[model samples]
Target: MSEDLSSKLLGPIKLHLRVTWESQDSEIKEYIEEGIAYIDGICGESDYSVSGLPRILLKAYCRRAWSGNTSMFEEDYRRQLLRLQHENGVRRLRRKRNE
Candidate 1:
């Protein structure tokens, strides 16, 4: 994408990540692309319009790219799993009262 176009598309994630409109840095671009791809994989399809918690996750993943850390990824992945399970109605079982 052109710098102009990419800049226009910058949302909270980009702002928080400090990705610039005139970003000629290859590393930033690569990490941002990786973040987008990661989100796509999680959703099981291609997605460009990102926002809300997913946007936060995308930023976190991109930051991880900069940090080169796996621990953050593991924690974030676990959080995503729990969120998915909750959304799917996989609730914890409640204990029964004794008679």
Candidate 2:
């Protein structure tokens, strides 16, 4: 949990890292390796990061991608709602039943 530890999701990819000298070398290696694999699957063959790219750039890219996805999803949902309302009478009154 140093300042160096960071995590980000870019597009469909995520990048994470944890650095320490706790002598838990196996755990450390697994953590970093898993990050790489996750990123690869999410990115799906994109060179999202340049060689020797700075951490800040990666973070910014991830934020943009994540937010963009969210925005798109919201828009799509709204459109679907509009379509449904149009198909059904949106202003139709609901009939109350007497018990």
Residue 37, model 1, lDDT: 63
* lDDT agreement with native, every candidate: 0.54, 0.34
TM-score of model 2 vs. true structure: 0.28
lDDT of 2 by residue, 7-75 (tens): 222211343323234454444333433434443333322232443222332333344443443234224
Alpha-carbon lDDT of model 2: 0.34
Identify the leading candidate in terms of TM-score: 1
Please state the error at residue 82 of candidate 2 in Å: 28
Q: How does each model score on TM-score?
A: 0.53, 0.28
Off by over 4 Å in 1: 1-11, 18-24, 46-50, 70-72, 81-99
> Per-prediction RMSD in angstroms?
9.2, 17.0
84 Cα displacement, candidate 2 (Å): 35
Tens-digit lDDT track of model 1 for 1-99: 345423433554456667566453556666666766666555433223545555566667767876787356846577774464444332222212321
